[model samples]
Target chain A: MSATNLNWRAIAAIYRFEMARFFRTAGQSLATPVITTSLYFVVFGAAIGGRMGEIDGVGYGAFIVPGLIMLSVLTESLNNAAFGIYFPRWTGTSYELLSAPVSPFEIVSGYVGAAATKSVILGLVILATASLFVPIQILHPLWMIGFLALTALSFCLFGFITGIWAQSWEQLQVIPMLVITPLTFLGGAFYSIDMLPGVWKTVALFNPIVYLVSGFRWAFYGNADVAVGISLAATLGFLVACLGVVWWIFRTGYRLKP
Target chain B: MRPILELDGLTKTYASGLQALKPTTLAIREGEIFALLGPNGAGKTTLIGLICGLLRPSGGVVRVAGLDIVEDYRRARSLIGLVPQELATEMFETPFAAMNFSRGLFGRPPDHALVERLLRELSLWDKRKDRIQTLSGGMKRRVMIAKALAHEPRLLFLDEPTAGVDVELRRDMWALVRRLRDTGVTVILTTHYIEEAEEMADRIGVIDKGRLILVEDKATLMRKLGSKQLTVQLQERLEAVPEALARWRLTLKDDGHALEYRFDTQAEENGIPALLRQLHELGIGLKDLATEQSSLEDIFVSLTRKAA
Candidate 1:
C-alpha cells in the first residue's frame, strides 16, 4: 500500500501550493461551473421542465441534477488537474518539484487531491444552485458523496495523464473538448438512456460516462438504468486504469524528464 | 577530504538519440567551489539536471553523501539544492511563500526564522511580501537562490546563476556564494563567462561536445595553461617581420604596426630582453611596449580549440 514512505509534509506542501493557486484565481475557476450549470438549469430545468413534467417518475428539473453535477465534476476535474500539473511544466517550475525529496505518490496525491477537492466543492455549489430551480431529495447522501469523490479522483488522474501527455496548451484542450464533452452530452446528462431506442440505448452503454452519471443519478433518485453495483464497479475499473497510466508515466519518467 | 558527490560513468542519451552526457565520471570534494565551464551545446545544464534528479540517466549510477541517487533518491535529493539556468514559474505568489513551500517540498518542517534569515541573506527580506511578478529581474534571481537554500542543503548546484541578472546581483551572488562556502556548504556552478568561474571557483571542469574534457584545480589549470603576451607598437609599419628577427618567431599584427610575442609565464628567462636587444639592433624603432597575462579565457579557447 505504501509505495515509498509517505512524506506527509511534502504532500501537504504541494497540496497547499496547488490549493493556494486555485484560490488565487478562485473567482474564475469556481465561476465556470456556477455559470454553466445556471445556464443548464435555465435551458434544461425550466424551459424543458415546463414542457415535460418527469422522466422515469422523477421531475424533469430534478432528473438532471446528478447528471449536471457529474458533467461539471468530470470536466472540472480534468481542467483543474490538467492545468495544475501542466502549468508547472509550462513554467519550468516542475524542475524544482521533481528535484525535491517528494516521491511520485506524493506528487500525484497533491495534484489529484487538489483537483478532487475543487471538484467536490464545485459539485456542491452547483447542487445548491440546482436546488433553487428543482426541489431535490437525496435517497442516499452517503453514496452520493462516495460517487462524487470517486468520480473526481478518477477523472483527475485522467487529467494528470493528459497534462503529461500534452506538449502544448492546444493539446490540453483536445480530449476534454473533443472527446469528453461529446461523450458526456450523449451519455444522458439531460435525458435517460432508457428513453432511447434499443440500438441507441445499447450504444449509450458503450460510453463510460454513462456509468458515472447513472451511478451518481442512482445516488439521488434511487433508480438507475444500470445496476448500482455495476456502475460502481465500472467507476472503480476506470479509476484503476487511470492510476495505472499515471504509474506508467512516473516509472518511465515520460514527459516529466528530459 | 571526503567526497560529497560522485558519478560513475553516468550517461544520458535522450530518446531522440542525442547523447547529452557521455559516461561522465567525476567527484566533488566537500566544501569546495567547483565551476563547470562550457559553451552553449556543452551539456552543462544536462549534467546539473541529472544530479538534481530532474532527468533520468540512461545508464550508470550517482551517489550523493553515500546515497545512491535512484535507490535512495529522496535522501540524496534532500541533501542537494538546484538553481536552474532559468526558471519559468508563477509570479503570483510571494517570495516568502515560495521559500516556505520549497523547504516543505524537501520534507522540512516550516522554519519561519530560517526562512527570514535566508531572505535576509539573499537581500530579499524587505520585499518578501511583494508578488514575484512585480519584482525586478535581479530580485527574482535572488528569490531563486533563497528558494534553493530554504532546505539548508549541503550541496547546491547553480546553473548559469547570473545569465540574465544585472551586474549588482551578479556581484552580490558571488559574495553570497563565498559566504556560503565559508559556512562549509559546497557550491557547484556552470558559466559561459570565464571570468565568473575565474573569480569564484577553486576547481574547474571544462565540458565540450558532451564530454568532460578536463577537470583541474583552478590554480593548477591556470598555472599549466597560463602564458604571457608582449605587444610592441612599432614606430612605423613593417611589411613583414625582418628575416633577421625570424629566430624570435614574432608575428607582425595591426597591419604590421605592432609586433606580438607569446611566452611561458613560469619560464626562468622569457628572452624578452634578448628580443628587445635584437629589435633595437635591427633598427626596429619601438613606439611602445607592454606585457599582459593570458586570462582564463585564452586558456579555455586553446584547450577547447576545434581540430583544424
Candidate 2:
C-alpha cells in the first residue's frame, strides 16, 4: 500500500479508538459540562447578578454568560483530550496503540479531533442553556464560530501536552483545574478587566485565556473589554505556541515511549 | 534462510539513567518460533518494544522483514504485530469492533470473515459482542491476541503471552501459536516460563541484565549444554558413598537410600557405567534405577547464574 494510504488508516484507527473511549463514558464527558455550566450560570449569573446590576451596559447575568461558556469549552476540551490520551498510559494499554503502525501526526490529530468535538458540543450546549436565563445575542455569527473553533483547537492541543506530561491522575487535574481554571476566572470571566486596578488590568492582558474569553465575548456582544484584533492575535499566538509544543513532544516520543 | 528480523547493536537507556537494553545484535529467521527467555528487568520487553517501534533505540538499528525500524518505521511497523503484556481495550468495545478498528489502524480494508475467523480461532466468537471488561482474565488475553492478529501481520511478538494465565488458556494459547507458525507467521516470544519455551520455541534466546547472552535452536541449545542424571535407588541404606567412588563426585540422597550422578549427555563416555561398576565393586546393591533428562529451566538458570 502507498504511504499516504497507510497513514490515513492509522489516523482513522487512533481517532476511532479515542472517540470510543470518550463516548464510553458519555455521562461524565457530555453531561458533566452541561451540568457544570448550568451551575455557573445559576451561581455566578443569577445569584451573583442579584446585586451587581450591570457591567458595561450589559446586565451582569448576560455579561458573564459568554465568559462562562468559553470557560467550560476551553477547560473541558483541554481536559478531555489530555485525559483521553493519558488514560491509555495509566491502564497500560498505550503499549498496544503505540506498537501499531500509526504515526505521531495521526495519533495527535485523532485525539485532538475527538477532544475538539467534545469541547465544541459542550460550548454550544452552554450557549443554548444560557439563553434560557438571559438571551445570548451573537453580534457576528461568523466570528463566534471562529472563536469557538480556535478556542477548542488551542485548548485541545494544550490538553494533549498535559496528558503526555502527566504521570498520574492528580498531575492530569493540576494544570486544567489549578492553573487554567484559575487563570480563566481571574482573567475577567465574570466582571470586566476595566473594573480592576490599572496595574492589574495590564497584567490580565498577559493571561492567554483572557484573550480567548475576550475574543469569544466580542463575538457575542461586539463590545469587548479589550480590542478584538488584539484578542484574536493573542489567541492565534497561543494556538501556534501550543501546536509547537505538541509537535515537539510527538517528535521526541516523550512519555509515549515504552 | 534469510533473516526475518535483525537487530544491530540495539540499546535503550531511559532518561532516569536506567539502561533498559544494552547494545546487542541478534537475528531471527522467518517461520521460526524464537523464545526470548529472561527474568524480569532483563530487557526482553525493551528489545520487543524497540523492534516493534514502540520505543526508540538509544544506540542501535533494528530491521523488521529487512525494513529499518526507525528509518523505515511505517513499513517496518506494518509488517509486525505485538501482543503486549498488558490487556488494553475499551470497556465498552466488543471484540468485533476492537479487531476491525485495529486492522483499520494498519490501513487494511474491512474483512469480516478474517475478523470472524480470528475470533473463533481464539474462542472469542460467542463473546465477540460482550464488552471486553466483562470477559474473564483468560478471555481478555485471547482478545488481546485476536486484536494483534487482526491485521494479519507476518511477524508477531508475544511478550509474556502466557503470564498470569490459567492452565487451560496457556495450553490453548501454545496450541494457537503453533497453528500460527504452521501458517508461516514468525513468532518471537518473551517468556518467564521455561517449560513454555521448551514446549513451543523452535529457537531459544536468553537475555539478562540488558544483554543477549545466547541464541540457538532449542534442540541445539539443550544438546550442547544439556545433561542427564543417573539416580540409583539402593536396596540397602549406606552411611556414605564408597571411597573408591570418590572420583565420580556422586551425591548421597534420602539418608543414602539413593545415589545421584550428573553427567554431560554430549560427552563421548557418559561415565555412568563406570560409576555403576564401581558401586557394584563396593557392594552397593541397587533396588531400581531411573534416568532424568535436564530441562530448559535447568539450562536457563545455569546460563543466567554463570553470567551473573
Candidate 3:
C-alpha cells in the first residue's frame, strides 16, 4: 500500500502512547533488568567463571555475555509487548483503537514497534552492565546488531499474539514465564550445547532459543554451537510463524471483536 | 440533501445466537439532534455499536456520507466520533494529553490550539493539567466528550451521555449538545430519559426487543399519539363513577371528588361538550374543570408496551 493511504498519524499516536506508559514507570522498568543482570554477573561471571576457564577459545566470563543478553532480550520482548496490548484490553480503552481509521497492520506496527524498541534498549543496557564485569569483544558488530534487532522484533510479534489470545492475567503470563523462560534456560543460556551428553546435545538442537543464542554468540566470538546460517534461518522462521498467527487473529477477530 | 448517516437493514447477532439488533434501517440528516429511546436490553447501545464500528453487523450496510463503513472504513470512520457508554479513558493522562492523543488517533495532525479550544469549550481547560482519574464523574464525562470532538468528526454519537449524572449536569450536557449541533456536527444520542428527547431532539426513534418500532419527528410524534386529560371537580363526593357517564370512560379520582376523562388529540370528536351536558342533566354540579396534555414519557411507555 502507498504510504499516503496509510494512517501514519494513528500509528505514531499508538506508539507514543505505549512508549509514554513505559517512560512513566521508567525507574521500575529499567531497574528490574539492570538488577537481574547484576545478579547474573555476580553469580555466573565472577563465581563460576573463576573455576571454569574457557570454551571455544573465548574466556568463560565473556562466553556467557551473549547468552545472558539473549535471555534478557527474549523475555523482555515478550513481556513488554504482551503487557502493552493487554492493559488496554483490560481497561476497555482498546475500543478507541478498534473504532479508529487504523488498519490491523498499523495497530500491530505501533504496539510491536514500541515493545521491540524497549527490549532492544534493555538488551544494550545489559550488555553495558556485562562489560563492567568482564571484557567483551565483537567479531561482527553489524551482524550482532542485526541479530539483536531481529530477535527483539520477532519475540515482540510473538508477544502481541499472546496478548490477543490471552483471556485473563494468568493466561497472559503463562506463555512468557512458564514456556519461554524455561526454554531459554534449557537452550544454553549458561553453557554451550556441545557440553551436554550425546543424546542431550542432539535434543537441545530442537529448542529454538539455542539457535538464537548460538547465532548471537557467533556474532561476538566468531564460533557457534550450530551453523550461523541455520540460526538465522531459524530466527526468520519463528518470525514468519508469529506473523502468520497475528494475521489469523485479526482475520478471525477471535477475541478482539464480537 | 443526502443524509450524513444511512443504515440499510443493519443487523447484529452475537456468536451465542442472540440477535442484539434486528434488520434496521435509518437515515439521519446533518445538523440535527436525533435521540434514540429504549428501555434496558432494547438494543439502543447495540445500534450505536454497529454504526461506530465497535461491533460488526451480521447483515446489511452502514454508510457515512456516501461511503460504506465496511468497504471505505478509513474514510467513513474518520468522519465519525463515539463517546461510549462506559467511562473508559486513559485515567492516568491529563485531559490535554488525552485530547491530543484522540486527535492523532483519528489521523489528524497535532493542533494544540484546536485541542485547547475544545477543552475550553467543555469547561475542562482549568482542569486540563489534572489526571482524569482525579476529576469528578461529570468532568470525566466532559473529558469523554472533548476526546470525541478533538478529531472534529462530522457525525458524533453520545451513548447514554447523562446516564448517571445529576440533574444540573444533565442540563449542562443538554446545552453542550445543542452548541455542538449549532456548530454543524450531527449529534445522535441514546437516552433512557424520555424528557431528554422531549427537551432537545429534532427527531426521535424508539427501539424495542431488537426492532426499531418507530422513528418520527418529535413534535409530530407528540401531536399524533399524545392524549389530553380532563379532570372535573365534582360539587359533591361520590362512591363510584356514575353509570350515566359510561360512554366517556370516566374514572373517579381523589376518592370520587373528581372525575377524569382521557381523549386522543387527533380524535374528530373529543365529546367534552356532550359530557358536560350530561353532567348538568344528572344534576351533578361542577365545581371546576381543567385539561392537560400527556408528555413524551407517556407516549414512549405506551409505544414500548404495545410492542411488547
Candidate 4:
C-alpha cells in the first residue's frame, strides 16, 4: 500500500495535468456529451416512444435512458483517454512524459483517472439532460453508482490500451468508429436483449458492451435482460485483463520506449 | 577521479536489422564537459538513450555512479538527467508546472527555489506562467533543458542540445552547461556541430558507424591529429614543377600560381627552410604566404572515414 502510495504524488500531478488539459476545451469535452445525449433522446425517445410501448415495466424511452447514457460514458471515457494519450504521442510531447522519473503505473493511473473523471462528469450531465425528456426512477443509487464506476473503468482501460497501441490519427479513429460505436449499438443500448431472437440473444452476451449496458440498465429500472452480477463480473474480468495488458506493455516499454 | 558514468561494450541492434550502436567502452569523469561527435546516423542518440535508461542495449552494461543502469534503474536514473535532442514538451503546460511535474516524477520533494533558479538560468522564468505551446521554439528547447536539470542530477546527458537555435539561446545554453560543470556536474553531450564540441568540451569522443573511434582530451585530440598547412601564392604560373621543388613535396595549384605544403608541427623538424629553398631553386616567386591549422571537424571527418 505504501509503495503504491509513493506513486500518488506523481499520479496526481499527471492526473491534474491531463484533467486541466481536458478542461481547457470544456465546450467540446463536457458540453458535447450533454448535447449528444439530448439529441439521442429527441430522436429515439420522442420519435419511437409511441410505437414500442414500455420495456420490462418501464417506458421505452426510460428503458433506454440509462443504457444510452452509459454508452456515452463508456465510449467517451475510452475515446478521451485514447485521444489524450495519442495526442501526446502524435505531438511528440510523449518524450517529456517518458523522460520524467514517473513510474509506468503512475502514468497509467493518471491517464485512466482523468478519463474516468471526464466520463463520469459527462454521464452526470447526460443524466440531468435526460430528466427533461422523460421521468427516470432510480431503483438503487448505490448499485447504479457501482455500475457506472465499473463500466467507466473498464472502458477507460480499453481506451488506455488503444492509446498505447495507436501509431497514427487514422488508427485512433478506427477502433472508436469501427469497433466501439458498433459495439454500443449492438450491445442492446437502445433495446433489451430479450427483444432479440434466440441466436442473437446468445451472441449479444458475447459483446462486452452488452453486459455493461445491461448492468447499468438494471441499476436504474430494476429490470435487465441478463443477470447484473454476471455483467458486473464480466466488467471486472475485462478490467483485470486490460490492466494486465497495460502492465505488460509498460514493463516491456513496448512502443513507449525510444 | 571517479567516473560518474561508464559504458562497457554496449551494443544495440534494432528490429529493422540496423546496428545502431556497436560495442563500445568509455568513461565520463566527474565535473567535465564531454562531447560525443558523430554524423546523423552515427548512433549518438542511441548511445545517450541507453545511458539514460530510455533504450535497452542488446549487449553489455552501462553504469552510473557505479550502479548498473539496467539492474538498478531507479537509483541510477535518480542520479542522472537527460535532455533529449528533440524539443518535445507539453504544449498545454506552463514551464513552471512542467518543471515541477518533472521534479515530482523523480520522487523529489518540492523545491520551488531550485526550480526558480533553473527557470531564471534558462531564461524561462519570465515565461513561467505562459503555456508551452505559446512559447517560441528556442524557449521550448530551454524548457527541455530546465526539465532535465530539475532533479539536479550529478550526471547530465544532453543529446544535441544546440541543434537548431538562435545565437543567443546557443550562447546561453553553453554558459549554463559550463555553470553546471563548475558546480560539479558531469555533462555528456552529443552534437553534429564541431564548433560546439570544440568550444565547450573538455574532452572529445568521435563516434562513427556506431563505434567510438577516438576519445581524448580536447586539446590533446587536436594536437595529436591536427595538421598545419603552409600556402604560398606564386607571382606567376609555371607549366610544371622543377625537380628541386619536388623535394618540398609541394603541390602546385592554378598552374603554379600557388604552392601548398603540409607538415606536422609535432615532428622534430618541419623542414620549412628546406621547402622554401627548394622553391627558390625552382625560381618560384611568392606573392603571399599563410598557414592554417586543422579543426575538430576535419579530424572528425578523417577519423570516421579512416574507420570506414
Per-prediction interface RMSD in Å: 1.1, 1.8, 0.8, 2.1
Clashing pairs in 4: none
DockQ (model 4, Cα): 0.47
Q: Candidates' lDDT values, in order?
A: 0.91, 0.87, 0.93, 0.85
Comparing candidate 3 with candidate 4, which one achieves the higher DockQ? 3
Highest TM-score model number: 3
Candidate 1 versus the native: TM-score?
0.95
Return the top candidate by lDDT: 3
The whole-model C-alpha lDDT of candidate 2 against the native structure comes to 0.87
Q: Which stretches of candidate 1 lie over 4 Å from their true place?
A: A1-4, B232-244, B253-258, B266-268, B276-289, B306-308
Candidate 3 CAPRI assessment class: high
Model 2's CAPRI class is medium
Chain B alone vs. reference chain B, TM-score for every model? 0.94, 0.98, 0.98, 0.95
Local lDDT at A34 for model 2 = 75
Q: Write candidate 2's Cα lDDT for B1-308 as tens digits.
A: 66899889999998888998888999899999999999999999888988887787789888888888777877788889988887777656898998988898877888999999999999999999998889998898898899899989999999999999989889999999999999999999999999999999999999999999999999999999999999999999988887898888989998989989999989999998888888788788899999998999999999999999
What are the per-model DockQ values?
0.78, 0.62, 0.87, 0.47
Q: Between prediction 3 and prediction 4, which has the larger lDDT? A: 3
**TM agreement with the true structure for every prediction:** 0.95, 0.93, 0.98, 0.94
Looking at candidate 1 chain A, the ten consecutive residues that score lowest on lDDT are: A1-10
* Among all candidates shown, the one with the greatest DockQ: 3
**lDDT (Cα, tens digit) per residue for candidate 3, span B1-308:** 99999999999999999999999999999999999999999999999888888787899999999999989999999999999888888999999998888998899999999989988888999999999999999999999999999999999999999989999999999999999999999999999998999999999999999999999999999999999999999999989988999999999999889999999899999999999999999999899999999999999999999998
Residue B145 lDDT (model 3)? 92
